[model samples]
Target: MTAMLEMRGVSKSFTGVQALRDVNFTVRAGEIHALVGENGAGKSTLMKVLSGVYPHGSYEGAIIFEGEERRFRDINDSEALGIIIIHQELALIPLLSIAENIFLSHPPARLGIIDRDAVYRQTRELLAQVGLREHPDTLITDLGVGKQQLVEIAKALSKRVRLLILDEPTASLNEADSAALLDRLLAFREQGIASILISHKLNEVARVADRITVLRDGRTVDSIDCGAQPVEEDRIIRSMVNRDLAHRFPERHARIGSPVLEVRNWSVYHPLHPERQVIKNVDFQVRRGEVVGIAGLMGAGRTEFAMSLFGRAWGRNITGRIALEGCEVELSSVPAAIDAGLAYVTEDRKQLGVILADDVRKNITLASLAQVAPRWVIDDVAELRAASDYRTRMRIRCSDVYQETGQLSGGNQQKVVLSKWLMTDPQVLILDEPTRGIDVGAKYEIYCIINELAEAGKGVVVISSEMPELLGICDRICVMNDGAFVGEFASGDATQEKIMRAIMHNKRTSNGARESDMPMEGVRP
Candidate 1:
C-alpha cells in the first residue's frame, strides 16, 4: 500500500541542540501507527515539524503526503491539508459550551452571521459519532477530564481531519474511559482515518497499533509490525533505551513497624452538595516503615479521600479524627497539614505539583522555605544546598539545578516533586498516581525512592489505578468503592482480582441500600 504520510532524512535543531538526526518515518492510510520513546527523545519535535510548527525552512526534511511533496509554513497550512495534532496538554476553553468549543475557529454561519442552532446540530452529531453521551449544550468546565478529551476528538473530526495525531491522550483517564477512547480509535480506523498515536502505555500500543516505531536520541531506532510478529514490550524498550532492562519494578524489603498514622471514622461531604458526603465513615492506619496502596476504579473517591486528609484539600464538610504518633492533630488547611508533618504529591504534576516556570532548585525548596531561611529573607545558598542534596538523593538527571523544571522529562519532574515533599520532612507522605506518565526506567528509580522512604521509618500511602503497580511496591492494599473502604489485604494475600471483586461487591451492596444509607464518597484509590 502507498504511504499516506512520509518523511525522509528529516533533521531538526533547537538552540545549538540537535533534536532530530536523519530521521525516517511513514504512516499508512487507515492504520494506527504508534510512536514510542522516552521523554525528550524528539518525538514532539518531529511531530511539530510534520504539523508545520517548525515550518519548512526551519528544518532539514522532506515531507510527502498523499504522493505530493508539501512544505507547510504554519499550523493552519497543515490543517488545510487534513492534518491535525492534539498536544499532550489539551487546548480546550473550559468555560465554553461543547458546541462552541468544537466550532471555535470555524463556526457554522449563514451570511456571516453565527448560526447557533446549526452549530449545536453539527456538534451533537459529531459527539454521537465519537460515542460520547454528553449534550452539546453542556459546559466543558463541568465535564471530567475524560469527557473533555472526547470533546477534543469531536473538535478534530469537525475539521475533517485525515491524519490524527494524539499525544498522551489517555494519560489522565481511568481504565474504563481509556478503553472507550481506544475503541473509538479503532472505529476511526475502520472509517479509513489514519492515526499517529503517541503513548507510553506499551500494552495499549500492542493492542491497537498495527505498526510501532521506536525513537531514541532524536533518531529512528526501528519500526516493526505488531501483527506480523508478536512484538514483546522488552524488544521495544531495548530499542528505545539500547539496554537490557532486568526489572521494571525495583525490589523492596517490607519493614513494617508500629502504627505511625491513624484515621478513625473519617468522613467528608461533597463541596457543591453539602448533604451528599463524598467520603463515608472510613477507618485505616499506616505503620512506620510501610507502604500502603489504595486501589479502586475511577469515581471511587480515592483522590477525594487523600485530598481531604491533606488539610481538607477537596471536601467541604469534613469530619475525621486523625492521630500521628498516638497524638491527635487538627489539619484544617494545607499549611496546617504541612506543619503537622504531612505531605501530599498530587497526580497532575504540571497543574498541581510543580511550578513549571521555576527552576528545580526553587521548586525543591518551595515547600520548606523556613528550613532554608533563618529569618524572613530566603537564603539563596541554603536553598541551593538543600536542592542539591535532593538532586543527588533522587538521582534527578538535568543539565543543572538552575534549569527550569519545565525542560526536564516527565520522570525527572516527578522526582523534583518528590524532592520538594521530602524536604518538608513529613512523617506521612501521600503519593497520588506517582508513576502515571513516566517510563519503566524512571518508574524503577521511583520505586527505589519509595523503598528508601519506608526504610527511613516514614509512613507512605500510595494511590494508583494500575493494579500491577500497587501489587509491586505496596506492603498492603486497601480497596475503596463509592467513597468507602470495603476491604484490605496484605501484599501476599492481595491480587488484582480480589481488589476488583471487593470494589464491585461493595458497590452492588451500596446501590441496593437506601439513599440515606449510602456511604460518603471520599475513599482513597
Candidate 2:
C-alpha cells in the first residue's frame, strides 16, 4: 500500500497551551489506520490540522498527500482533494431526510434547481454501498444512532471521499451497530478508500486496524504495523499511558452497609407517547458504601430509569417510591431530588451534563449554589475556593478553573459534571456511561472516583453499556431488559455470558418465543 496522507512535524497550540507537539501520522492508500490516544493527547488536534479545520499557516506542519505537498486553506480545499471528516457528534440535521443530508452541500442540481430524483437515486446507491437498508426519504431522526453513522459515511462517499476520517464513530453505538460500522470500513478498504479511525476502544482498534499509532502528551509515541507482528493490548496501553497498567480497572474493597437508596414499583411512560411505558414495574436498591452496576443494551431503558428516578427529568406518568435511608422521599422536581440527597451524572455530557460555554468554576458550583452563597448572594471567593478544590481533587487537566468547560477534553468535562453533582453532597449518586469516550488512563481515574464516592458511604449506581467495566467495579450487577430488571448477580457470580443469557431469557419470555429465536449477538459487546 502506498502512502495516502502524511503529516510531518505537526505542531499546534492554543492560547499558550501546546495541543500538538511535533506529531507524525500517516495512513496508507487502502488501509484502516487507527489513531489511539488519551483525551487531550492531541489526536483530534492533529486531524483538525490535516482536514484544514485549523486551516493553513495556523499550525506548524507539512501535509503531504499522494506524494505531493499540500497546503489547505480551509475544509473546502481539503474536501476538493477528497478528504472528509466525520466528527463524533453526528452533523446531520434530524428533521431532514437522509437523501437531503447526504447531499446538503452539493446536491444533484439541474441549472440551479435540486434534482430530487437524482439525489434520491444517488443516495440509495450510497446507502447500499454502506449496507444501510433505510430508504433515502427516511428522516435522519427516524434512524438509530448506528444508521445515522452510516448516513454520515454515505454523505462522505457522496463527496468522493478518498481519505475518510472517523472520530469515535462507535462511541454511542450498540455492539451490533459497532460491528456493522466496522464491516463497512472493511468494505471501503476493499474499494481502495483509506480511513483514519480515532477511537478509545482498543478492542475495536486491534480488531480492524492495519496500523496502530499511539499518541501521548501531544507527541507520537509508537506506531505498530499489525501485519508485521501481532501487538498485544498491554503494549499499546503502556505506550499510550507511558506506564505499565497492570489492571485496566482499579481494585476496590466493598464495605457494604445498610441500604442507602431503595425504589419500589417504579414505572415510567414515554414522554412523547403517553400510551407507551418505557420503564416497567421495577424494584431496585443500593446499599450504602456499595457500587451497584446496571448492565443493559442500548434502548433497554437503563437511561430512562435513571433519568426518571432522578427527579423525573425524563418520562411522563412516572410512578415510583424512592427511599433514602429507609425514609420515603417525594422527588417531584430536580430541586426536590437534590434536596433529598440524589444526584445524577448524565450520559450525554456535551448536551445535558454541563454548560460548555461557562467556566469550570461556574459548572462545578452550578448544582449547589447555596454552598458558595450566603443570604442568596454568591460569594465569589468561596465559589472560587470550592471550584479550585474540586478541580485539584478531580485531577482536571486544564490551565485553571476559570477556563471554559468547552475547551477541556472529554474526560475533564466529565469530571466537571461529576464535581457539580458531588457539590450537592448527595447520598445516592447515579452515573450513566461514566467512561464512554475516555482513554484507558482516564477511565481508571473515573473508576477511582466512583470508588471514592462509594467509600464515602454513598450509594453509587452505575449504568454502562460496557459489560467489562460493570463487572470490574461493581459489588453487585443488575441486568435490565426492556424496561425491567431481568436478573441480579453478585460480582463473584457475574459473567458476560450469564448477563447476556439473562437478557435472552427475558426476550424469550416477553416475546413468547423460543430461546433460539432470539439473537444475542447484537447485544453482546
Candidate 3:
C-alpha cells in the first residue's frame, strides 16, 4: 500500500533546544498509527510541524503527502490539503450551538447570507455519522466532555479530513465513553480515514493501532507493525523506553493510622440546577499515613464530593460536616478551608491551578504567602527560599526558579502545581486527577511522592478515573455512583470487576426506583 503521509530526516529546534532530531515517520491510507513518547520527547512538536504550526522555512524536514511534496505555511494550508489536527485542549466555543461550532470558519453561506437551516441539516448528518444522539441546536456547554469530543470529530469530518490527528482524545473520558470513542475511531477507519493517535494509555493504543511509532529524547526510536501479526504491549514499551519495564506500578508499604480527616453525611447540590442534588449523603474517612482513593466513572460525583468538602468551591447547596484531627471545622470558602489545614489540587491545571504567565517562584508561593510574610509587607528572601526548597524537593526541571511555568513540559508543570500545594503544608491534601496528561515515567514519580506524603503521616485523598492507578497506589478504594458512595473495598480486596459491578448494580437499583415512582413520558428506551 502506498503511504498517505511521509516525513524524512525531520529536525526542529526552538531557542537552542533541539526538539526533534533526524526523525522519520510514515502513515498509510486507512490505517490508525499511534505515536508514543515520554513528556517533552517531541511528539507534540513533530505534530505541530506536520500541521504547519511551524511553517515551511522554520523547520528542516521533507513532508510528502500522497506522493507529492508539500510545504505548508500555516494551519489553513494544511487544512486545504485534508490534514486536520485536533489538539488535546479542545477549541470549541462554549456559548455557540453545535452547528455553529462545526461550521465555524466555513459556514454554509448562500449569496453572502448565512443559511442557518442548511448548517443545521449538515451538522445533523455529521453527528449521526459519528453515532452522537445530541441535536445540532444544543449548545456546546450543555454537552459532557466525551460528547463534545464527538463534536470535534464531527468538525474534522466537516472539513473532509483525510488524516486526523488526535492528542489524548480519551484523557478526560470515562471507561464506557472511552470505549465508545474508540469504536467511533474504528468505524472511521472502515471508511478509509487515516488517524495519528497520541495517547499515554498504552492499552487503548494497543487495542486500536494498526502501527506504533516510539519516540524518545527528540528522536524516532523505532516503528513497529502492530497489524503484521499478534502485537504485544511489551514489545512496544521496550521500543519506546528502550528497556524492560518489570513492573508498571511501584511497591507500597501498607501502614494506615487513625482517622485524620472525616466527612459525615456530606451532600452537595448541582451548580446549574440548584434543586437537583449532585452528591447525595456521603460518608468516608481518611487515616493518617494512608492513601485513600475515590474511584468512579464520569459524573459519579467523586470530584464534586472532594471540592465541596475542601472549600465549597464547586457546588452551590453544600451540606457537609468535615472533621479534621477530631475537630469539626466550618469550610464555607477557600480561605476557610486553607485555614483549617486543607488543600486541593484542581484537575484543570492550565486554567485553574496555575497562573501561566507567572514565574515558578511566584506560583509556588501563591497559596501560602501569608505564612512566609507575617505582616502585610512582602518578604522576597523568605519567598525565594520557600520556592527554591520545593523546586529541589519536587525535582522540577527548570533553568531557574524565575522561569515561566508555561514553558515547562506537562510533567514539570504538574510538579509546580504539586509544589504550590505542598508549600501550604496542609494536613489533608486532595489531589483531583493528579496524573491526567503526564507520561508513564512522570506518573511513577508522582506515585512515589504520594507514598512519601502518606509516610509523613499526612492524610491523602486521591480521585482518579483510572482503575489500575487507584488499585496500585491507594490503601483503600471507595466506589461512587450517581452522587453516592455505594461500596468500599480495601486495595488488597478490590478488583476492577468488583468496582464496575458495584457501579452497575447501583445504576440498576436507581433506575428501578425512578421508574416505579415517576410516570413515563417521551423518554426513549
lDDT of 1: 0.90
lDDT of 3 at 187: 95
Cα lDDT tens digits, model 1, 221-335, are 9899988999799999888778888777778887888877888788999998999988998777899999999999888999999999999999887987888876778899999
The order by descending lDDT is 2, 1, 3
Sum up the clashes in candidate 2: 0
lDDT of 3 at 76: 96
lDDT of predicted model 3:
0.88
Q: Is candidate 1 or candidate 3 better by lDDT?
A: 1
Alpha-carbon shift of residue 108 in model 2 (angstroms): 0.8
> How much is 172 displaced in model 2, in angstroms?
0.2
Candidate 3 lDDT at 83 equals 95
* Predicted candidate 3 versus true structure: per-residue lDDT over 1-525, tens digit per residue: 899999989999987888999899999999999999888889999999999999999999899999998899999999999999999999999999999899999999899999988998899899999898888889999999999999999999999999999999999898888999999989999999999999989999989999989999899887778767777777777766677777777788867887778777778898989999999877778889999998888888988888888788989878856778877778898989988889999998999999989999999999998967887866989988999999999999887799999988788899999999988888999999999988888888899899899999999999999899999999988889999887778888999998899888874323233212432222223
TM-score for each candidate, following the candidate numbering: 0.94, 0.96, 0.94
Tens-place lDDT per residue, model 2, 309-347, is 988999999986777887778899999999989999999
Candidate 2 stretches greater than 4 Å from native: 507-525
Model 3, stretches more than 4 Å misplaced? 507-525
Q: After superposition, how far is residue 347 of candidate 3 from its true place, in Å?
A: 1.4
